[model samples]
Target: MTQDAQKDSSTYWKKSRVELRAAGFDPDRTAKTTAVVTIASAWTNAHRCNNRVRGIADLLVELLAERGGQGLVVGAPAVSDALTQGTPTAGYSLVSRDVVADCFEIGHYAHHGDAMIVISGCDKTGAAALMPLARTNAFGLVLYPGTSSPGKVSFEPWAAKGTNLTIMDYAEGRAAQEAGRISAAELVELERNVMPGSGTCGAMFTANTMSTTAEAIGMMLPRGASHPADYDAASDIHADVRAQARASVEALYRLMEAGIRPRDIMTLRAFENAITTVYAMGGSTNMYLHLLAIARAAEVPLTIERIQEIGERVPLISNLQPHGPYAMTSLHAIGGVPVVMKELLRAGLLHGDVMTVTGRTLAENLAATPTLEEIGKQDIVRPVGQPVAPANNHISVLRGNIAPESCVLKLSGKTLEKGEFRGTARVFDSEADTMKAIRAGEIKPGTVIVVRNVGPVGGPGMPEMVMLTIQLQGRGLGEDVALITDGRFSGVSHGILIGHISPEAARGGPIAAVRDGDTIVIDPGQRTLNVDLSDAEIAKRMAEWRAPDPAGRLRPGSVHDKYVRLVSSAHYGCVV
Candidate 1:
């Protein structure tokens, strides 16, 4: 705490008169409450998105000071990254959720501020910030730093270069090299600048997906999802992102005065709106996982089945990618979430009356937001009637012998065109083994890739398999194969992938019983996933199954180590 802030605190208990005057009220009679501003952010520059978090935090400090409120930045744990294919925070020294949970818990218990501005950049941080906000029921606002702009890189033959070559396209680059299409030097060059600067990966990946959900659920202001980190502070709309920081904090101040809390906006009806919005946008599979966690915090009952129920009715209207060809930057061009939500509201898919942080209803926010007519027309966000995927919302809740609790399938991206897949299981206990087999071209066309011992309990953090999925895509075998796991997939993962299976292999689920060459079938039309074996035969096989020895995992004293022992199935949102 600063000396000035300490002095300000001394008088805060008796400052009704002073605050009334500062708020433009007649001090003689007006009773205005002072709002202490707390700034929470994950500000590490390990990624470009983190830079935006830091910048926003600094900007909030300045804005709150101008508003005559004392503010201080609270340090939160940044999800340390090393390798991701194994588990969510596999290679990192810290267990991500444990760190993130503590970050919010500390702030909530400390009562650092009456009103808070949560500044987070990426996927996990959003969930971390969200849970405690709901738990504390504080008057606060969540602001994302925004998606990063696409960096340019060039490869050959497959058009994986320039704005076309996102970091995720590195997998495609590798495939091109092995096919003798691109040279080794070209591959190196593409990897070098695939991510030119900071932002999240250039797809509807976890970061973008969570940010979009935040806006859809009314926890954030409209159109904050797709703005590129704009490190230069210049966004496509309004002014620089710095101005957005100021505006967001100001909104927080106003909401505090109005006595609005996060619980008011994130109601059961609002969760439905969020679920519907996610389906319409072909959002991240991680949504199923994180939304479950957030819903648990908010005391809302939600599950993959309920989510798929919404998906069954809503159409996948946007053509955004890691599944499609467009990026967050493209969404920004046509108008961001406001335009998209407006169209969804027109379809009666979202709760237009849900309240938001800005003290406006969802309908009012969309109505006030200028559309593509003012921003210049674009087709990035398609009409509901003529969507990218009209048959389904690109989300499937599969239940069968394989996943009793239910598994989620994202049929968006390139995976949309595929039908039922029946293939032999090529089981690998870890993502590294799967990646190795993929690089060696040992995987067959009718393969059902199974990576086990990496779910919530075994993986202990349930990492998203971005590298493996992208590698499969690069090999030109994306739709030809099916990957299922107890862990999860990145939003960019397309092509017949199933994840978030309950009773993970480590817990002696059916997945542990499977041997090499066991047949697996995924029928999207029926929303079923099963292995070709009799129930008794499956039972006999599982009777002999055993979890991998945990000698090499995070040590016993570590939080990750503790998680392996206490975390529930992914079916339970992986909560402890």
Candidate 2:
């Protein structure tokens, strides 16, 4: 690990024990390792979320090889720019979990990998790695590059540095600019500094939300969730970063020694435990998507109905933005996600008997943490009795005439004002059209904006769109207006946003048949979303419906075309 002490100029993987040991590798093993652990990472410069991946991957290689095992890197790419409208990509955006997971699966067999140390720095990459980790069912451990530090940006008085800003601030700035509260110049400056550095945005968005939930589910090490990518040199997060990465590598090695695997930890009970935690944290809707994909790979029987049941029982508890007043950095300041899980476990909300990467039970991990009582008193994570939502079940599945396969709704924003909504359908064929209407002041209150043909098969990777939700909120319509789509949403997004409408428009779902001005009702309290129409009328509409063309105008033999042909519906997790 310290150096390449010896080399076979002709071949790799033919080193003698002496050669390995001369490099300071420790060959004395208490138990034999089956094979080199695969270190999977979607390493790219396209996003800061992937910034720490290479460093961490390198550290893992050294740790694994030093401990009488081998390690190698498998990289994948998922590129999208949050700064753009609806977060469009410059190119090559239709990458799939199947491809990313296949890298690990193929490597698991090709190299006889016995365990895994996977890296997920972005939305799809994280979810992608989870599936292969589950499929391998080996002694696997997941660790994020960690969330990004918040940038100090705002246009309140001048283009002065204000509080921490994430991607959500882009909408806030644009909203302020249009309202005449700030100028276009200020909006431009705010956008420039909104995203400070790499790592997931400093909110409970998809990446960080899944990172936090991964810890709660017992696949990640304690205190590994919300550390900043690059913080002050004196900050605790930067003090011993490599040591932390090495700790996970060691944990995976030990897990392999103990003959433990992902399926053992990601069981039905553990998946339930993770769902309960996601509800408590007001986490991303993507968790629903990724969790399903992981369940299928792990062969766990989890369903939308089952998730709705968990939401009914678990209350939204974490106060992190855009769901509440705090950010992910604050969560780390208060002892990270392990402390949060300890609180949930104390409330009997988590299955404490579940296996973990540390070769200990979930209960044991909590018990080992001496700071639980000390940090349990913080406002970062509220007590169960006083949660973010006044009521329980901030996330649930809606079933009726429109979404018989069920659509999901986010009911946990701190500014949320209603539990139910009724409005006329204002349909749009594409995100660009929907954004144009909202910006032009054409979308009004009492409107259910339906943007169809954006599901996994339709968008051809289900390109996430919290932009519409955020745009409405910018126009002061977060609660007054409602939006439903077959696309995905950014986790930081708030409002009466119903995403992942299953049996997507591309597949002739009822959402494709909806017409403008049709009465669309979304009542989370009743657990239903419906269009007021006779079954015969709805059938007639569907019978004559035609799938819309791809928004990206995908070409044949392209990545998007492949996703369209092979991807599953949002109902079954859009898995391939």
What are the RMSD figures for all models against the true structure?
5.4, 5.3
Instruction: Tell me each candidate's TM-score.
Output: 0.89, 0.89
| Backbone clash count, each prediction separately | 7, 3
On residues 1-576, what C-alpha lDDT tens digit does candidate 1 reach at each position? 432443244244335667646856455432232556667787885655566676677777777767766555777766633235445355332246546756765764464456667776667786666776776666777788766566565434424433634556666677667756678988887777665556666667777788888889988777777777763324332244666677787788778778778889889889899888877788888788778888888788787667777767887877777667677777776677777788888778888888999898888888866654455556677778877877464777888897888888777834434567889999998888888898888997989999888787777677777677777777788878889998778776777789988788888888787778899988888888898999999898887776677786778788777777777777767776
For candidate 2, write residues 1-576 as lDDT tens digits.
Answer: 101211111022323446546756454431243356778877875556676778778877777767866675777765543643374442233255567778777765554455678877776677776787777666688878777776665445322324456767776667767866677877888777676666777878877877876787788888887887766322333433566678887787687568777778888998888888778878888788788888999899998778878867887778777766566877887778877687788888888999988999999988966444565466678777777665455777888888889788877744334656889999987788898888888988899999987777776567666777777777788778889998878786788888899888888889888999999988777889999899999999988987776654688878778777878777777777
Give candidate 1's error at residue 15 in angstroms.
11
Pick the lDDT winner. Answer: 2
Task: Count backbone overlaps in model 1.
Answer: 7
Residue 164 miss distance in model 1 (angstroms): 5.3
